[model samples]
Target: MRDMKRIGNDRVTSIGLGTWGIGGKEFPDYSHDREAIEALRYGIELGINLIDTAEFYGAGHSEELVGEAIKPFDRDELFIVSKIWPTHFGYDSAIKAAKASAKRLGTYIDLYLLHWPGDSFEKIKQTLHALEDLVDEGIIRYIGVSNFDLELLRRSQEVMRRYEIVVNQVKYSLMDRTPEETGLLEYMKKEGMTLMAYTPLEKGILARNKCLEEIGKKYGKTAAQVALNYLIWEDNVVAIPKAIRKEHVKENAGAMGWRLSKEDRERARLCV
Candidate 1:
């Protein structure tokens, strides 16, 4: 597996396996159950220990597949992260959702998160509290939030300060530049919170960016590698780029062995 990073007290692979394609409703479903299991098995062979999914992905079909795929591997070597949907915001729903996710995953989740910051702040707070209780009860190792803005992050942190909230899952990439503009990157880095970069390849848009192409040519890398490297080299940031192809999986992992110089960083920042 690629080198791991410490999120609070837990160790996770730097380049995680984004499970959306294998499990997402919008993406092509696996041709058959074996394809999904084989893809996950391939990811493990490549040292991708972190598999990111949500209860919403295939309505839990993804986690079920993940569980089945990783059954032969040592559970401790994998960093499994799954999310709870926003509709399940109240304490009861939050608790129930966590149990359901755990049941479907067939293993304890390494991290659980609030999928989004929906309308009810009180319900969100109750859900965070319930997650904290789960951690205490040894049901989950860490708790976090996703798709939250600065104000929501501040609000969530107020509740989570007493607990162990280590990461925030968000859409971040060279093509989607909002996270940089909104000051969430700075806030997250300073708070000792890891930024789990979902859609870090911009849903495949960065591969078409001219700026990325130019940078990739300079480094002799693909546009996707350049975009992913931009996030991987930044402090306190990790990305989960989905890939089922062996060549693409290795291409994603290849971004890890180099340092983006100050000039490269400046060029990438200009694109953002």
Candidate 2:
């Protein structure tokens, strides 16, 4: 397996498979269903055991694909994550959405999340309480939120005094360093919360960057590999780059089991 990061008591792979583009109709160009399934299974074979999906992605098509791809693998060895959309932020709706997601995933969700912040604090609190109930009911092992800024993350934590937020899935990449600038990454490091970077490659841009290419050449790796290596170099962070091709899955797996030198890491930071 690749290096693992602790999210509460659960140990998950530092690199996971993101299913955004595999959600079929949502990303038509990249939605080759058979190839998507093959890529996901190939990723698992390479020891990338964390799989992230959401009910919002293609109205649950992503979860369906995840369920199919992971069928032959040992379920206990995989860490499955899914999310409930913002429209379902209330207690009852959140519960319903979670159950539906679990059904689509064909397994208990290791981690469930609120896809985004609600309009009101009360609504967020209600949703958290509902997620906690799901945890108690054995439907979800942990709860988290996504797309939350520092204030929203803090508020969500404040509401759940008894439970911990396991992750915050957001757009973080070599090209986009907003988390670092906003102090969110520092805060998460202090709190021991996992920051699951959703777009570690910046939609394939960083993979083709000259700076990353130069860095990768020293290590005999590709720019994409270097970019992914830099993202998960920290203990508290993990990166999930979506791949629907078999070769791309193998390329992503190559990002693990290596370290970027301090100088190259700095160059990657400065060059971007």
Q: What is the C-alpha local distance difference test score of each model?
A: 0.83, 0.89
Local distance difference test, candidate 2: 0.89
- Which ten residues in a row are the worst by lDDT in model 2? 23-32
Q: Model 2, 1-272: lDDT tens per residue?
A: 46888989988888999998576665665447778888899999999999999998877888988999999999999999998888888999999999999999889999998888868879889999999999999999999999999999998898895688989998898889899999999999999999999989988888889988988999999999999999898889998899888888889889988889988899989768
List per-candidate RMSD values in Å.
Answer: 2.0, 1.5
lDDT by residue for model 1 (38-157), tens? 877887887878888889888788888888989999999888999999899888898899989999989999999899988999988999999998888777889999999988889888
> Where is model 2 more than 4 Å wrong at Cα?
26-31
Q: Which regions of candidate 1 deviate over 4 angstroms?
A: 24-32, 270-272
Relative to the true structure, candidate 1 reaches a TM of: 0.92
State in Å the error of residue 208, model 1: 3.3
RMSD of 1: 2.0
lDDT of residue 164 for candidate 2: 89
